[model samples]
Target: MEKGSNHTPKALEKMRQRKWSKATRAKMQGKSHSAETRAKMSASHSGKTLTPEHRENIRKALLGHKISPETRAKIGKAALGHTRRLGMKHTPETIAQISATKLQPENRAKARAKKLGSNNPAWQGGISREPYGWEWDEPLRESIRKYDGYKCRVCGVPQMECDVALNVHHINYAK
Candidate 1:
């Protein structure tokens, strides 16, 4: 295919459907480019920078693309044992520079506004803070502890045998 040539969806689908013989696939398997060729390819694109428009175009092109499970597994396997920046730490000067950028008045205001209740993206209308139930009180907890013989169901240890206080937890929150 020529560089920058248009490949319509139908053409691309046809290419994907076409399967080469096993021998043809095997011929190119486990092959590496020559050192000189690799050097030339690297040098051709060294120190290149993409314009803002080009970056935006690439981002938009990939916005809604989904990777197959096979591809995702391969990526996970490839990254299993790699650490990109092992033991790396910013110097005091670099830390100061970052703090100065974050401490700007506009940046501080934006951060503070984002953390405001209801205004925050994670806000859930304060449902988490609502009381559980009238029955979910200290008396009910003590009754459950007595019913369980003052012992942990999982550990089988009596509350009197341990220094830490024992708690009776509800098995079902909705109840």
Candidate 2:
């Protein structure tokens, strides 16, 4: 007969009926999913996630779609080139189709820059900027030379190859 007594049961029912989004479910189950279940889920989820009927409908819709012959040729050429460059025996037709799609110039440049950046020493686990309190002294420099085989560890061009004398680097200057 108490008005506030209803609130406690209502809140408990609401908590029991709580629904978690897929992301929240995933995070809550973090690092605890069984390997077999995880593998099954991963394999099942490895697609566009469209139903067969929906995909068929989309296919029917695009049945009359047209692309320029020149665009088609460029895509085929690029796919073939990729296969040759990668030494791959087979290039997926789906990959060719995706590449044929239009992309912004900036997006293309960013992709190219990313690919190039991966090859650069500074980006590929190489040190950037001078170390704190870096200095050159006889014992320290000799230790550096010995540790690095008298070569620049970052650029790998060799300390002897450097026009400027290489300096000894301390990992923790405050220490």
Candidate 3:
């Protein structure tokens, strides 16, 4: 018996209370830890550096994991066929609209340049001097009145009933 176990007071205490087994002692010790300590332990383990041999082992494990060329070709063929089927059903105008929306990088750049030029006073000279486009037009007012049924376009309330004059707004000022 251990020195503590041989003592009369300790032996008496052990007799009075049931002694925990080794497995029970281990389980109790495991359950004694606080949640904060467990999180810190998990975080510390996550930062551990793997050995070169371990990395090599992982690489070897994933060596044959890629999709084969034949499988890739099959997937590619299926996708192309699916796209062709979908595209074939679309009307020419629909296709044209879709194609127009997908502007090339160069086209996008030109558009951005044009927009910036129009907005920036420094580049104002680069654009046309004509001030008569969509802005400040009697025709625009007429169109807005027609679209809104002679109602205030700002609040969508009737223009005849409202106190304020209907302000024709180009919803997107970017235009």
Candidate 4:
């Protein structure tokens, strides 16, 4: 509509005259648009790309939006096994990006610091801090690693491939 013509007396009269009845509005409430209308709507949005600023605006708008528990559960249930690459491996670039992200020990500490002691799932009422008559030194640990061919006893990962030292747990846990 022409900007100045929209609120003209004739246009106001036309709009007031075209108001739908309550019954007509009720009938349209649950009804969808016709195929032609849907096609026109789709065409109007086709080939339109959001500008970077618009995309940033959208991101900022949704930054702190919270989903209710029920909505989150529904979304999770709907998303189960629906990934485009459900069972595929991450590409090398993704793996590199992930490794780079995890390279900082400070980030790992900051994350775990929130869930230590009583807040942790394996808290065990602080029993983990109690030594179970076990006092193996670094030399003993090295011997155990040497005995195990310098690789992970379970997954068989080589010691050199591990970022940290190989842990040799007690026999009960080594099982």
Top model number, TM-score: 1
Query: Please, what is the whole-model Cα lDDT of each candidate in the order they appear?
Result: 0.84, 0.68, 0.72, 0.82
Whichever of 2 and 4 has more lDDT, that candidate is 4
Model 1 weakest 10-residue run by lDDT? 166-175
The residue pairs in collision within model 4 are none
- Residue 97 lDDT, candidate 3, scale 0-100: 83
Q: Which scores greater on lDDT, model 1 or model 3? A: 1
Instruction: State the lDDT of candidate 4 residue by residue for 1-175, as single tens digits.
Output: 7666548798788676667657557877988999999999999999999999999999999999999999999999998978797689999999999988877899788878888889887778866536633455688779988989988878888989989988788335832
- For model 1, how does the per-residue alpha-carbon lDDT over 69-140 read when each residue is reduced to its tens digit? 999999999999799778989999999999999999999999998899998788898765466655577787
Candidate 3 residue lDDT tens string, 1-175: 6666565897778765655656556776746568999898998899699999999999999998998899999999888746546545888999898788767777788867776855666665654536445465778767867777887545667777868656666454433
Candidate achieving the largest lDDT = 1
Q: How close is every model to the real structure, measured as TM-score?
A: 0.34, 0.21, 0.21, 0.30
Error of 2 at 125 (Å): 64
What is the lDDT, from 0 to 100, of the residue 72 in candidate 3?
A: 100
Q: Residue 52 of candidate 2: its Cα lDDT?
A: 94
Q: State the lDDT of candidate 2 residue by residue for 64-139, as single tens digits.
A: 8998999999888888746444654436876776676537677788767776755754584443433433444477
Residue 89, candidate 2: C-alpha displacement in angstroms = 9.8
Error of 4 at 161 (Å): 44
